[model samples]
Target: MTDQGLGKDDKTPRTARGERTRRALLAAAAQEFGEKGFHEGSISGITRRAGCALGSFYTYFDTKDDIFRALVADMSGQVRDYVSPRIAEARDGIDAERIGLLSFLEFARSHKELYRIIDESEFVDAAAYRAHYENTAARVATRLAKAAERGEVRPDVEEVHAWAIMGMNVFLGLRYGIWDDSRPADEIAAIANALIEKGIGTRPD
Candidate 1:
């Protein structure tokens, strides 16, 4: 539920209806931005997609740039929320990673716009782009550290290791999730999991 980097303020909705309106705007913005890059996407297109008025758009976001930033944060939270519980259900630390990737592939397949929007954020909003990946890597590092404490992985597991794994997942998701999804998600996860296990799992001397 991390807000990425957005802060709550007076603009934040207090009513359920207001929240729904804001969410609709964000979802519509995702479609508009996803189909058309930031520069091409327009605020009017977002309102049209959301079935709301121009005034309604301003009700939640001050401008297109504002919503785009919010979208990045929202999507980051969405990914974490979708994958974390599934990972928590894993039998062990290594299994958690396998589940994590499997869930992410499924998410990417369904939300194909995810990659395009996130990638575009690198140029459109560098701060949000960096925050998204940094937050993701931090989560991975935390999980790895916990796994190590549980004797499930090498005790020396560190941030660099987490970044490495995150890097692999990002591309793996692009290949198996966005570009094409003919292959089974679990199959991809298992393959990647094996690599992670061999490299980091505890072993006997």
Candidate 2:
């Protein structure tokens, strides 16, 4: 009845428990969605898989669509977390490009579920998906710009080049990482790094 709603002690435990339940649900939802596309997935199925009640799903998400959106956001954040540090260490120019390419492949290998979700989402919801992809590319471009300024890559290279390199990684992930037979993640990363760096590396006059 008070502004605390259920009172202090009650509210605290409820909030903590709710958060834990919500995170579990989302984790399960991401796995389900990645395995089965959004259209084929259901709230009941997600809740069942998560071991939560039907009504509890609404406490965290109003609908399946809401859950999907949240999953995309979470997956994007995970990718950024995985790649940002490696990119940060690339203060040396060529190493920046090498790091960026390798980091992307490694991230995909580490989070294949999230990567599959992202890839499928792009075709079904191009606008929302592209916005997130472009934002990531922009961040990578900033790193590339710094490297270019330091003579790491060709000065004439544009941010689009960064986006292109990222695209190559995405397709490679689709073909080799996700679909093809197992190969070492490092070996795949090395192949991608070679392709991107060779194309982008500075050439002597």
**Local accuracy by lDDT, each model:** 0.92, 0.74
TM-score per candidate, in order?
0.93, 0.81
Pairing residues by index, what is the TM-score of model 1?
Answer: 0.93
Deviation in Å, model 1, residue 122 alpha carbon: 0.8
RMSD of 2: 5.0
- The reply for model 1, stretches above 4 Å from the true place, is 1-8, 199-205
Native-referenced Cα lDDT, model 1? 0.92
lDDT of 2 by residue, 75-164 (tens): 888778887787778657666666766666676666668666776777666766987888888887887788778887779878788788
Q: Would you give me the overall lDDT of model 2? A: 0.74
lDDT of 1 by residue, 1-205 (tens): 1134444465688899999999999999999999998999999999999999998877677778899999999999999999999999999889999998999999999999999999999999999999999999999999999999999999999999899989989999999999989999999999999999985557785
